[model samples]
Target: MGVIIVLIGMLLSVNLSIALDELPCHFLDSINITDGNRLANDDSIEFNGLVYSRKQYAEINYVLLRDGTDQITVDPYIRGCICNIKPCVRLCCPLGTLNTDDTDITVCQDHDKGNKFEAEVIHKNNETKVIPLERFFAYIEGIPCNFVYFDDDYQITHKGEISRGNLSTKLTHQNSCLHAGLNAETNEVDLRLLTCIELEGDDYDLNQYHVIRHQIINFCMLISVVFIVATLLAYIFIPKLRNLQTNCLICYLICLAISYSLVIFVTSFGYPSFACIPFGYFLAFSFFSAFFWLNVFNFDFWVDFQSKHRFKQMSERKKFYLYLVYGFGGPCLLILFIYILDNTVQLPPNMRPGIRDGACFISNILWYFYTPIGITLTINYVFFLLITLKIRKIQQDIAAERSQEDGSLMQKALNEKKETCILYLRLILVMGLIWIMEIVSYLMDNFSPLFLITDILNSLSGLFIFILFIVNRRVLRLIKERWQNLRGKATTNDNDTSNLISRSAAFMQMNPILTIK
Candidate 1:
């Protein structure tokens, strides 16, 4: 096992580096510098957080140097800005002053941050000294640098030229990505700044990036598969584990495993090549996993508050049916509703903006952003709040019962129940917090680096449930006791063998006469 793990790591490092080298350098190098250019032609410069249009730039001098340096390559001199300029047409006013024709101009500014604060470009066989916002039209037409920022750290100082039409933007900053957005109708280029930092000596290769992404995806898929296989075996072979499968944890595990299988199938086996099916499977199953885990959490309230009155005497089959109706069935209904919405409104699995790993993934759609996530979060939050209250009540009940009882086993049991309630409350509260953080992080932005944080929270959430449900002391003790009982029964049977032999001998002695005859 140790040797296998080491070999896998080695393979990943070597292959990943090789694959990264295969991806296009230009694609990876396109990081968005935030507010890269701010036009400030007027006397006073106003610093707004974003780029302003030509109309707004007329009155205000805006200083917009791009932020998000960690994600972008910075060249101090080359920057783009929006400014207002006067056209060729000029009007003679009544006061004998010529009013120049004002027009919107996108000015490409080049600055020397070094000792030479002034620079010039030879245009039309004339050397023109660079001035702030002067000859805006000519500068826009002539100057070279389209994107610019300062490099604080000397990682990649390779100076590159930008062709007039060559422009791109990073759609997302999740990983160091460079995506281009262009307006074909107007022939305008809009560069999108991203927040992903390219690693030093990072050679971008399309095939390599795809392979790395596939491997990481495969690794995560493998985790899901292992959990699924283990869960299946535990349920099928382990009698005790099988009997203990009444919680939401198992339901979540089952759903997650199924979801992963679906993803793996679509991505690898290509069973459902239809766009809608993969997205539906991804959303439905992922949400189901979350929903069921929350449903498990809802037990805090149900078991404590409504357990006695609602389903206390209900048959096991009825309970199973009820869960299936609400728990499993609800997600299915939701998927159906979403599908209907998609079909009617011309929306389904949203195709990602850029080419993905040869598979169409659900893009960040409006529905995913607001509707499903909002609904799931609300459900989980309400469930957690209600469960927390019930847990407190359970603890109180245990305490009250213990106080009334004398020094009997009943009192001890009540005390134990109190402790158990406390533990359950802590567990549920922690679980709720984890989900809250995940939902919050996800909703905030696509470029959030906190995805790793959310992933960690998810992993911990699973680990907590695993420990609580399967590895808890009480559960272990139950298994141990069952094993001991089995051994005891076997030992008794073994001892009875001696008695059986003696009884046989006695029977043989008594029947000796009869036997001889």
Candidate 2:
């Protein structure tokens, strides 16, 4: 017994000896910085350059609780360090005085554990209802529990969705199941299995540790949007660029611009919570519209390769209008599908659009957004294959039999198609690689250090479009011609005005008496 006492004393001395700075800082899970939220540890937020490990935060928070420090001052200094139980959870932390579980967060598991519960809850602007949920806690310590997820929209949410388990549940119902490690003056770190849930509790405002990172991302996206708008203007103002092909390019750029701009707006925190769904819907439409137009561009090229429609550009106005329907209208249908799902009661909680599930915007990215994008990309690939086959057949036919005029016409059309194909290829390569990086980053939870690569590529997409379409030799040549025409017309108009003035002066001088009358 004396030896045991000596060992315990040594352990106490060791714990006391370690300075606050020596505690191990929890590593970031993703550079995208999910709901983990620049956490200094499981309990404390890294605030005003202050940091604390899980053990350190709990101990300090407990000390403050004993000293009667109000939550008003404590909230900014700590997150997930709860004295009250209503909003905090203990299941993830541990129950009982000596429970040594190291789980730092009250995160929902990917798979539900044990039996599920049908939680009776208030539906906002609607009647009360019972939601069948699998996971346990509605709150992770002091903060409302958030889902663990990887998605494409890091900017709009700048965080993950708050856990749905707690979303609709009433405070009383939520309080019952909620548990968190508390520093309430106890023999050791205290845990209350029950009776700790408060009627009301302090709200923790999660401090954003690196605000500059998000600002830089938004600025880059805004810059890309400006370039996209510029490309649209270049195409629209030039009459020579109003051909069906350029019109298609214009449509794509317009959608691209709208999407990028919306990204800036939503992420900038310029809108209210009520506007999240609509913002998400429009953003989805713009992105899908851009993708659909790219599909139309590919399809138009494939048809041009067919000898029968060698001059498809001549009567392409009608077809271009139809292509607009497919481009714009298709995304409408997709958005409609999402809305239907969002409103549907039969769908599981996780499968839903999740715009409000946690982070806002279309949170179920795989189902609502990327899936449609993948399908469209696959169709574009098919068109690419067909174009390759058609080109081979045309070359064979031209070699086998052709009159001088027919061969020349065919050869000219062939060169145009080849040039257009190269342009399409470049566009596809850029967008495709970006999308691939995005998916990889979304799925790669372990590679926090590498999120920068994918994010930079994403922010540079509009800039990529500017380079691919606007900076090309053909567009530049047309811009040059348009500039010279404007200059020539300006010069001619000036000369004509001078000549008229001179004639008027001569006439007035010759007939001064008549002019005075």
lDDT of 1 by residue, 73-158 (tens): 23322122321212110101111121121110121222222111112223444434443222322111111122322211111001
Residue pairs with colliding backbones in model 2 are 88-141, 89-179, 89-180, 90-179, 90-180, 146-163, 161-358, 161-359, 162-358
Q: What are the lDDT scores of the predictions, listed in order? A: 0.41, 0.55
Candidate 2 per-residue lDDT, tens place, 1-517, comes to 9999999999976775453222122211101111333554354444323343354332111112211233232211223322121122223332222222222223322222222323333344534444432232232222222322222211100011222332443222222233333332352332223222222233121113134556777888888888888888888877655667678888888888888788787778666545656677788888999999989888887765543453454567789878888989999998888888877655886899766443557877877777788788888878878777766765666565465455554554555656767787678768876776666676785234455567667777778888877797767866776677778842223243234435544533442221111
Which model scores highest in TM-score?
Answer: 2
* Candidate 2 steric clashes: 9
Stretches of candidate 1 off by over 4 Å are: 1-214, 235-248, 264-272, 275-279, 296-303, 346-361, 369-374, 394-403, 406-411, 415-431, 444-448, 456-464, 477-517
Quote the positional error of residue 445 for candidate 2 in Å: 3.0
